[model samples]
Target chain A: MSKSAILRSSIAKKYWMALTGLFLCTFLIGHLIGNLQLIFIHGEEGRRAFNEYAYFMQHNIFIKVLSYVTYISILFHAIDGLMLAVQNKKARPQKYAYNNAGANSSTASRQMALLGSIVLIFIVTHMVNFWAKMHFEHIPLHTYEVTLPQQTNPEMVYYTHNHSLIPIQVDKVVVVRDETNLYLENTDLKLGEGYKDLHSVVMAFFGQSKNGFVTNSLALWATILYVISMAVMAFHLWHGFASAFQSLGLRHKRYTPIIAVTGKLFAIVVPFLFAIIPVLIFIGYVK
Target chain B: MASKTININLKIWRQKNANSKGSMETYKLDNVSTDSSFLEMLDQLNEQLVNERKEPIAFDHDCREGICGSCSLFINGEAHGPDRAVTTCQLHMRKFKDGETIYVEPWRAKAFPVIKDLVVDRSSFDRIQQAGGFVSVNTSGNTIDANAIPIGKAAADKAFEAATCIGCGACVASCVNASAMLFVSAKVSQLALLPQGKVEAQQRVLNMVKQMDEEGFGNCTNTGACAVECPKEISLENIARMNREYLKAMVSAE
Candidate 1:
């Protein structure tokens, strides 16, 4: 083993970022698929089924090993990114006086570390709320169904618009309801069930506030943080995923474009889907 | 082209030796031709300096044609001057305006220690290349027929493009990572693409990349700056190829 880091080149650092990032992307897909199960069936049956799904994932030996790999991948990705960034900083040693070079790249891509750190914070909070609860937190596995049936209502209010032919509704509201109406029988109240009751557990956090107004306010703030973090994540993955593949040296001209498009699709579509889950739950659209 | 003359200020770096303190010494030049190549302008300044009994400003040069890549200068804020896809020797004085101040400096890298004023010891690149940038082939020259081998057009073009890397230190100078990934990848890909080189590709890439790391050059951050400043426009794709090769080597070694 090369004991000294003096010989480490930027090329090696790129490989480090690429390999670890690609691994994380794979992990994200698996995570998204697992989370999507929450949207499948509903009521007590849905919760039980979801819990069973979560239980199998958490307990399976193969998955356990994969989970360890995933953990290492995250740590490696973060550390390697820092290393590459530091090396790059040293490489240029000087700064340009005037930089008007923005053409194709985005601010988000240029500021990857900032975006990643923000997402990291969100990940920690997310794990504490959901992942930790599903794993370490010993919560009751009694499945609770949260529901928000589609609802739209128009309330008459005067618009302050200076006369226009188009009539704009001044106010619109969608009502949602949460009810713990369903239960599972003969199923062991286990860790996975804790995940299915995810909606109530999250609401329970907001519900902890002594004042109803404070609870609603806290829930709104939580939703905002979730949305902002997910958006940042979307941007980070947008540049990172395809860039990682290129860095890892998987550049068949044809497949390169394909991978680029697929990476973008994943970054945009998956995060949008995740964003929806929070919106739906916060608005009481899903119970 | 008309032989128009222009007077300009130059902030050229001067250092007697590596241990000596370096500073930018300014010089004024007049009657410079519009069509005069940048190196010719340097020659005029050196002639004037000799007449004035001052040591002629030291710089590096070889074939004035851009191919040899012996000439390198950080003109103003740009590497190899403002002209795109060309080295400093090939950059014409026409690119500059009359009375403009030009800042020139040697390629700065810890790996590329300055040998004198404008020339650095680039043998580090040679060392990197020597660290297995070639296929382990004995020069029998009788092993393979050109017609017998086949490669896809895209792969062949990419390979040729990569091979065009003139081993200039421009990529190192321009990269914020001081990454020679572009250079290393070019060498790795050139061999990895052909059947003749396939036999030793694994060991070749592994050794080259290892040596590259050992050279104290920074990592490739994929900023695309190296590609931008490369006289040949060598793509970041070369880095990608090296990555694939390294990964393959790792798995095969297993």
Candidate 2:
């Protein structure tokens, strides 16, 4: 109970995990709301509206800073989870071959680290595709001046590989040309000036009407990952939420059941709602 | 109904002693009754082994009534048996079909080393309890009103449920993490709920958890597997309650 010791023990690890996981949960809600715009608005109007939201989020100093914090939260949550799991594993070096008691917990809950690792792989792939192009890559603002490449349409090539590349186009329409510079018209909006920055790229990526199938498919995968990850998150939160309260010393018997149920309700409802946005967009049921 | 009899096979673990090699040895038992409890059936098998001039299967048991909880065995894949709520001693042969092969093993935990065959040294749980669990009050000739504590029925019921844990290592045996939190929590919780033990509540939680850690029991991941397999259905809430108490104790000591 010494001040120095209190800062060091398994209890400290629990606090770190709780704080980081809760922070990520906040980020999920915000991300869902932004993604939900894909359903509410369609075509140019939808593109513009979504663009505006992305621009505001990117340009806003608070959100810009929060994005960095979000990155840190992800790292800390993973590390703390690993530390706790490893410590727990080392605490008991023995294992039973037949465990019939596993019926009570979901596979995701039992294999949290495994699920998190898969989600982590997805996140990395996702960031490299979209986030890299939007933030890291020096995508040209003006596409008209750039000569058309000698291969298949760059937009199609990009889409088939990674859905993060939003075809650049002006007014949601652009001219297509063959290698001979002949007039061959296609509506798959090519890359344009809006993709020069992070926010514009996000807006253009989600807003464009052409390549509807590709865009929707990517959204579906994202939604699936979001849903699966959130399901994992929910299971994590299932044990975590109630355990956090106890770790923080909330033990009033009357409040304990209330907190436990509240924890469960929050765990289920939040992820379930967040998972719906991508499905709505992908199925063309929304925007 | 009168007890029926049947023949069964038991793939039991045999060790000359803890110092020697252990392996699975199959033994055939004849005329085991469907109405006989699992322990009684074991008794029948042991009687046969003894009459045949073989060392009977080494297992632990005391009060055959299932209250002592010393009868620890892994029946088939289950910690106790297929029944949702019952101990091994309480498990009846009726749950199994005749001529079935039953795999009986001791409680598998690093902390609960095998004393012999199915009997394990679960004294680590006792050490965790001895560290600082029981109410400090001495048993005197004085009788205090039970109502003096003013505990609500719900709290009293929960306390009783927690107290139902008979120092069995089933929670440790069944847990994937081999966590003893339920057992430790039960002891810490039962005493903390009553005023008679309030004076030493802070020390009790701290000492018990430390002893629990020292005994090599895994931390509670709150998977709730223990509660499901618990012969007593000891709630995971008790573990949560213990965490709260331990946290409070840690802070107050600071």
TM-score of chain B of each: 0.94, 0.93
In order, the Cα lDDT scores of the candidates are 0.71, 0.69
Give the distance in Å from residue B203's predicted Cα in candidate 1 to where it truly belongs: 3.0
Which digits, one per residue and each the tens of the lDDT, describe model 1 over residues B103-142?
8888777777777777777887898889877765456876
lDDT over C-alpha atoms for residue A157 of model 1:
26
- Deviating ranges (above 4 Å) for candidate 1: A1-16, A33-66, A87-118, A133-196, A203-228, A275-287, B1-16, B20-33, B41-57, B96-103, B134-159, B194-199
Residue B240 in candidate 2, Cα distance off native in Å: 2.2
For candidate 2, give the docking quality class from DockQ: acceptable
Expressed as tens digits, the lDDT of each residue in A1-287 for candidate 2 is: 65543544444455566677667767877987886676666655665566557657767899999999998888877776776667667655544434565555545446666656665666676678666775656543321334446575554333221557554433333334332232214643333324233333443333322422223335445556656876776776666666566655565769988988987887798767766655655455554
**Highest DockQ scorer:** 1
As a whole number from 0 to 100, the lDDT of residue B98 in candidate 2 is 84
